[model samples]
Target chain A: MICLAAFIVFAILGIFSATHRRLAKQAFWCVLRRVTFKPCQASIGEILKGKIVGWLLRRKSRWAGWVHRYFEVFSWIFVIITLVSTFYTVKGAYFYIRYGTCNPEHPEQCLISTQAALEKGVINPYYCNDK
Target chain B: MVENSWKSQFPFLMQKKNGQPLIYFDNACMTPCPIPVLEAMEKYNKEFFSCGGRSNTHFGRDVDDKVEETRELVAKFIGAGASQEIIFTKNATEGINLVARGLNLHAGERVLVSDREHNSNLIVWQVLQKERGIELMILPSKSDETFDLAGLEAELQKGIKLVSVVYSSNLDGYTLPVEEIVKLARKYDAFVMLDGAQAVPHHAVNVKKLGVDFLAFSGHKMTAPSGIGVLYGRLAHLENLSSLLCGGHSVKDSRYNGFELEDIPARFEAGLQNYGGIIGLGEAIKFIKQVGFDFIAKQEFELNYFITRELKQIGGINFVGVDDPKSRGGIVNFYHEKMDSNQLTIFLDESANILTRSGRHCVHSWYNSRGVKDSIRISSYFYNTIDEAEKLISALKKILGLV
Candidate 1:
């Protein structure tokens, strides 16, 4: 539980920092244009050249829409995997509480309903053959 | 007082073998001691060298008190009922032999043992069965060189007198299901004796909670001096058993006609005791406790993972035991058809400055049974680092390629 809470807090802090950097970059570009008293920053040819090189080298393709769609699909898959693993760890911990550990001999003892053993002063609810 | 590093404890470990620093990975055979254990033994040898409980003199009484204090420390460490239950022997082998010799095994009775047992645990029973006209029932092991629970249960269903097993296989650091074994022994009315040479140092071994009748382990494996280890028997069993060795301190009154015996522990501990070694063992355990078992387990587990991953990359190096740290401890065993284990060890030592144990590891019968002629073993302790493991892996790969 504590680990989950810590992860959430760190995630929020990371997103906040990323947004702050993006906003700062936009503000700086606007200030530079105003200081130079110019409506436009660069020639279309120069901009197109840089974009083409970046797109081919870094962004992979000129079809920006499909690239963004692929990234979004992969990002969602990554998030799902992370969330599933988090749940798996939580499940393991819960089972550890229910049955002491994952002793193969007593797999049934790892269930949550084995809490009655705790009342009976049997702290190791996980030992499948505790009886 | 708080010596945290391995070099500080076992300075010899840091000494260069060739041009490289000695990377000792044979912990299953014996561990290098820390400074505190050495100092404790030094104090005993230099200042307080007296036979315990033999004389009423000042030195004798002081030595007696120190011996008892050491006993108390060992007893508490294992969670034994009392200091009286803990018997100081030469080593775990002698301790197990004591039980084999002392326990009353009838001619028709059976002694149960697992397939994964070290020869120390196996051969003693075999010798007893041959000498004393008892039957030795060998329990089958699983495919992974581990005790088969179901097969063990089938064996336990029989009328067995004693169940002698290893808590962890020195061959591969595979831990047995101790709690389950103890429970089954209870059902069959058998006394369980654990060869805990591999388990005690790396993990938390609470004898009372584990509820075994007798437990034996060597001090050398736990960073103590050799020839001074323990045999922890329940007080009832200790009182009931016969002493195999008899001499000074064991008898109450000796005459030309007859002799009367003293109380247990002392009765079992005959001759002039290993005063220096016992005191050193006590200090070694104290040193381990100070660092903490949990920390030790965690460090060794990480090392085990690194070793497994690295070794897996090398082809034909078959690792024994359940590769997970949660199930196993810090011992890794591997064998290759290309080279002999001893040859591998020699190359690793001469070329790479890595110290590894090879061959049967005192469990000859176990190796023979599985058709494994020899195997290279790398057992780690908390003091071992990932870098040392890498060195060992590289050496092994080099040796493997050569063969």
Candidate 2:
């Protein structure tokens, strides 16, 4: 449902603004109803879709049509992207704390953590995880 | 531009808003005030800002005079029997509430209302039906969405106590037949009141000639400020209606133990009233009289015809009420079968600064009954131009990808 994606977006936006905070609450309720197998009776999903497509319609009619027609599909894509992104972020944090490198498989990829090890005058930067 | 049009008079339309010209089509909600109305309010607020009816100073005297003159102007504007019949209210809803509480109907007494009433006209009666043990009857419209006079006759025959209905529907702009309704009520010896918020702005409503017992309309719906409204009643009826609020200015004389209520208008109006709003409304009425309703009506008809005709060419657009635009006053109410009304207007606003009202529009009862979730409502006033209508069409066309 578009409500889940809208909830994430509004929740992120809600941190800095009161208007988006109110909308985030509505999106929360809509997502709650949806997960409970009830309808998205709050109508916030349609409103969010309208806002997005309406903005697009100002610049490109074709994009407006595509998005308006399959907004639900796009919402699914956003949710999947969010879940994947969250999983990687949490994993990166855990690895950085455990082994002094965010990417233990390729220590050089994490310049900040690798640089910190190099600062201690290690002959090879892999020494941070190898030890 | 149409000759003798008041477009130049409204300061809001003089320039572009955010590099795009603004086209305001939401007159049913509230009309923008002209310069004269604004100036009159400014003059009052700056010059005679003193408390009216409380001091013997020149400022207080001017305020009192201005207030009385405005009352007389309102009485003449609506053709009431006398100025004593005009009671200044917060808005039309307060006027209707005053009547609902004032009438003091007993248990089993009946009040009939049309199905397409504004919430102001509907909810007050519903509260009464609950609290006072009165019977609230809903009169359904004809299949064509016009008022059913035969239905009224039947309901009157069934012994209705009062008939309160909207003079013109804010939902779709379909006007009720007030003459026949008044005749039926008079024949049945029942009181008739009109919620004139929509009617009084564009129509020449003469309540005395029409023999209506009570009428209510908002000043902001015309060209005035928001806080002022008029409630017109026959002097006899007003004498009988109870005051809804009582405090500082509502009483004639006060004692440690008791106080006497002031006469008529003062008896009902109970505070430091909206003097600025009243002055603005008076000036607005003056402007309306100078422009004339004939010109207002003609401008409205031309605009509605153009908008309705062009909107029809768009896909899946179904109109509310009659197909004819002229008969629907200044309102063009409809929804797109392919596009949600809320979405459609959002797109319109996104493309251009064009404005319109959408969603349930406060007639949830009618919409709920007809299974309509929403509608887009646009209205044209005298100041609204044919160019604005074309802009609206072009905006809609752009949204639909037809242009």
Q: What DockQ does every candidate get?
A: 0.00, 0.34
* Model 1 chain B lDDT-worst window of ten: B1-10
* Candidate 2 clashes between residue pairs 3 or more apart in a chain or in different chains: none
lDDT of 2 by residue, A3-109 (tens): 78777878878999999898889999988998899866427887777678767766777888888778879989988887787688778888778667777666667
Per-residue alpha-carbon lDDT of candidate 2 for residues B342-383, written as tens digits (9 for 90 to 100): 767766775677889888788999999999888899988888
TM per prediction:
0.73, 0.89
- What is the DockQ score of candidate 2, to 2 decimals? 0.34
Task: Give the 10-residue window scoring lowest on summed lDDT in candidate 2 chain B.
Answer: B394-403
Q: Which candidate is the best by TM-score?
A: 2
Model 1, B202-228: lDDT tens per residue?
A: 888999999999999999999898898
